[model samples]
Target: MAFTIPEGLHPDLNPLAWMVGTWRGKGRGEYPTIPTFEFAQEVTFNHDGRPFLNYFSRSWIIDAEGEIIRPGASEVGFWRVKEKNVLEVVISHNTGISEGWVGQFDGPKIQLVMDQGYSAPSAKIVTAGVRLYGLVAGELFYAYDMAAEGQELQAHIWSTLERQVD
Candidate 1:
C-alpha cells in the first residue's frame, strides 16, 4: 500500500504530505506500572493549505474478541514544517497531557525529541519522550519511548496503520 502525496499542498508542507489521510490499526500498550492491553486506534492527518498538518487520534481498549470495552486515549495536534528539514509539533491530549516536539524530517520519516512537556494536576506525568514516525511502504509506522513514573525511557507504544479511504 503506497501512500499518495497530496497535490496542491502548501509548499513548505510537501515533505509531510504522505501523512495526509486517515489511518486505522491495532496496537499494544504496556508499562512496568500497568497491565498490558490491546487497543484499536485511528489517526487522521489533514492540512488546510497551510504549513501545518492537523492531527487527531482516538483509541479503544479491546477484549480478545476485538470488542471495544471502553475508550482508551485520544489527542489532537499539529505538525509544522519550519524549514526544509526542521519540523515542530504541538499536541494536546484529552488525557490531560500536552507536549511540544522538535525534529528533522526527510520526507518519509520524522524523528523527534521532546523539547517541552506539560501535564494537568489530574494527569500522570511523562518526564520526556522520543518519537519516530514514518511511512513504510505506505503504512504509518510509529513508535514512542518515554520516561515516566521513575521508569527510565522505554518502549511505550508502537503501531502500523493503513490508510483509510474515507
Candidate 2:
C-alpha cells in the first residue's frame, strides 16, 4: 500500500498524498426532505509520474438483503494546481455529469466551486455548485452545495468514508 511519489507530480498536490489509497465506508444522505438513503462507496486515488492525481469512485445502495441496488460510477479525473493559489479538478462520470472545479486547499480540506454542464445520452444540465472535502480523524468528510432547479444554496449531500485496508 505504499506508492512511490511521482517525479512529475504537481507540488501543490503533495499535501493530498494521504488520500492516495483505497477508501470504503457507508454514509447517510438526505436531500430536501427526501427519505434518507444508505449507501456504500469506494474511492481510489493514484498517481503515476504525472502532474495530477488520478481519481475514481464507485458507489451502490444496499437493500435489506445486503445486495447492491444501484451502481454509480465516476471516471478518473485530474487533480492539479490551476493558478498561483488555486487548484482545479476535472471529473467525468458515466452518468453524464462531467464537471470542472476551481478551489483552494485549506489544512486537511479542499474547497471547490464549480460551474459547468454535462452532455451525454443521459441527463444533461448546467449547474453551479460547491463541494468541500475535509479529512478528520482519518476519515474523509464531504458536503456538497448546489444551485440548480431554481433552488437557492442548499445542502445536497454529505458523506463520510474511512480508508480501507487492502
Candidate 3:
C-alpha cells in the first residue's frame, strides 16, 4: 500500500508522517503484581498542520477468545519533533497519572524514556518508564516497559496493530 503524507501536515512532522493514522490490534500484558492478561487496543495519531502530532489510545482487557472483559487504560498525549530527531512527549492517563517523556526517532523506530511524572493522591506512582514504537512489516509495533508500585522497570505490554483504512 502507498502511504501519502497527510495534507497540511507541518514540515517538522515529516519524520513522523507514517504514524498519522488509527491502528487497532490485540496484545498481552503482565506485571509483577498482576496476572498475565490479553487486551485489545486502538491508537490514533493526527495532525492539524501543526508541528506536533495529537495522540489518543484506549485499551481493554480481553478474554482468551478476544472478547472484551473490561476497560483498561486510556491516554491522550502530544508528540513533538525537535532538531536532530529528538522527540518530546507529554501524556495524561485516565488513571490520574501524567508524564513527560524524551527520546529520539530513527527512521521508523522511536524510543522514549520517562523524564518526569505526577500522580494523584489516590493513584499509583510510576517511578520510571520506557516506550518503543516501530513499523514492522506494515504494522505498528508498540511496547511499553514501566516501573511502578515499587516494581522495577520491565515489559508491561506489547502489540502489533494494522493501520485502519479510511
User: In terms of TM-score, which candidate is strongest?
Assistant: 3
lDDT (Cα, tens digit) per residue for candidate 3, span 100-145 = 9999999999999999999999999999999999999999999999
TM-score of candidate 2 on Cα atoms, chains taken together = 0.81
Off by over 4 Å in 2: 1-12, 32-35, 64-67, 73-75
Off by over 4 Å in 1: 1-4
List where candidate 3 sits over 4 angstroms from the true fold: none
Q: Each model's TM-score?
A: 0.93, 0.81, 0.99
Candidate RMSDs in order: 1.5, 3.1, 0.6
lDDT of 1 by residue, 1-166 (tens): 5546687678888778778889999888788998989899999999888878999999999998889999998999999998659989999989899999999988788899999989999988999899989988778998889898789989988888988886
Q: Between candidates 1 and 3, which one is better according to lDDT? A: 3
lDDT order, best first, reads 3, 1, 2
Candidate 1, backbone clash total = 0
Which residue window of length 10 is worst by lDDT in model 2?
Answer: 1-10
User: What TM-score does candidate 3 reach?
Assistant: 0.99
